[model samples]
Target: MTDLPLHELAIERHIAAPVSHVYKIWMERLPEWWAPKPWTTEVVEMDARPGGRSAMNMVSPDGEVSPVEGVFLEIAPEQRIVFTDAFRAGWIPHPPFMTGIFAFAPDGEGTAYRAAARHWDEATMQSHSEMGFEAGWGAVADQFKALCEETWVAR
Candidate 1:
């Protein structure tokens, strides 16, 4: 059998907005389009720095809530961001999960955005895939694009 990568799902899209704008929304406007609406999201704490915390709650329509808490391993303004749920703030170890890297680069007048998820093993990768990684992350990306373009057009 072939070897499975330790990394999991990754998605990319070309968003018709500036790199800075795309980066800004990921942090500042996250809650607006974080979850596929009907299910909304809320930010609890986001210091947005290396070793800083990133916490949010995603609430379903029926009031079920799921919290995502993690730390920013790296933050390159308007360029890239790396965070992981494997550890909480202050470098405290938690249950090992997924690490994510979000990046934006100028593509023509817009930006090329990428969200890549890394897992510790094949099992974790498979679990995230089965959890609708594509559909869910894709939806949020679309929502983010619309929100950014709409706001840009309005300005």
Candidate 2:
């Protein structure tokens, strides 16, 4: 097998919520926690299946919209999701950026969550790191955990 993390950026967290619950919220309410505070996400489409399209707009506080379009490579419910910006829907090729891998596993009464972005090269990986990958992705993960825990309590 090839080394997957050679050009990867990742973040992990143990969320205080069940894997099922975390996955459910992640799938159904992505925009709620996708972007960090003051930045927002608007989902254009999210079809959670292999080859399905996943499009969204990340809106800045000043209303600048950064459109993101990708296709899902794999989706294992309550387990993992892998997607790539290399291809839009219908297998149409696009300029490649990175492939996103997110995994969810049961950890006692909580969930072990991991999110990774695999880049095509070291330059792109470095670029992503320079773009505040840690702070930004960490904030998103924290948001996700908080939402899951809060929602789990409200359930």
Candidate 3:
């Protein structure tokens, strides 16, 4: 393994719900509010287990569809999830992007959800950061929280 840049990015948001509830929404109904605008998740398959397959089709504003497929590296139900964009369904190496880890922790009557991405190089990290990752992701998180709250209350 070569020496990568090792970029770490994290965002924490308080969702108006319990950890289990929030986690369920994330895993089951992620496409509801995953992307603030044009993007959306079409979960081709989600096994929620180590070595399980996961794929999502993301549509851009201009109607360009980018299919991101990967595998679950780790999964701690209602606590944490670790996934990588290493291989797609065809068992081919997909675009070399960073790994993602999403964690949910109990907060007073709510849940503290954290989304983090680990990049392999400084350039990659900087490029993503410069592309408004913080703002875009923040918006998505807000949307996610709202969706979760709504779903929980409706249940």
Candidate 4:
């Protein structure tokens, strides 16, 4: 199990799918389950490698778009992914809210998926928590689990 730092928030789920399938689905279909219901995600570009750029826009129901730009710090296929908004591609500095860490491991015939958000300070973590982090991340997890399980089972 990954240690939970003081400035971090995380959620975990056990999905009825293999780790490889879960990881592949997440990388290949990120825009589908990245956002909660009533809000959709659009992947502008994603280079799934260390130091690669990861960009996306989340569109609200009312058409408000929130763009996110980050760089991948690490990508261990079927194991883990780490990214941060602290910098853009080519190491350009940017205002960062948090660093994202996602891990996937095999649990029998399923996968143990963990998603974590690491903030720069406790205040930032608190702000994220107060912004419905639990509900939002939980909903996204459910969406992802359902998609991975359904897709894997159907194949």
Q: Which candidate wins on TM-score?
A: 2
TM-score of 2: 0.97
Tens digit per residue, CA lDDT, model 4, 14-42: 99999999999999999999999889999
Clash count per candidate: 0, 0, 0, 0
TM-score of 3: 0.88
Query: Which candidate model has the greater TM-score, 1 or 3?
Result: 1
Model 2 RMSD in angstroms: 1.1
> What lDDT does each candidate get?
0.90, 0.95, 0.84, 0.96
TM-scores for every predicted model = 0.94, 0.97, 0.88, 0.95
Model 3: residues >4 Å from true position, as ranges? 1-6, 89-92
lDDT per residue as tens, model 1, 101-128: 9989999999999988999988888899
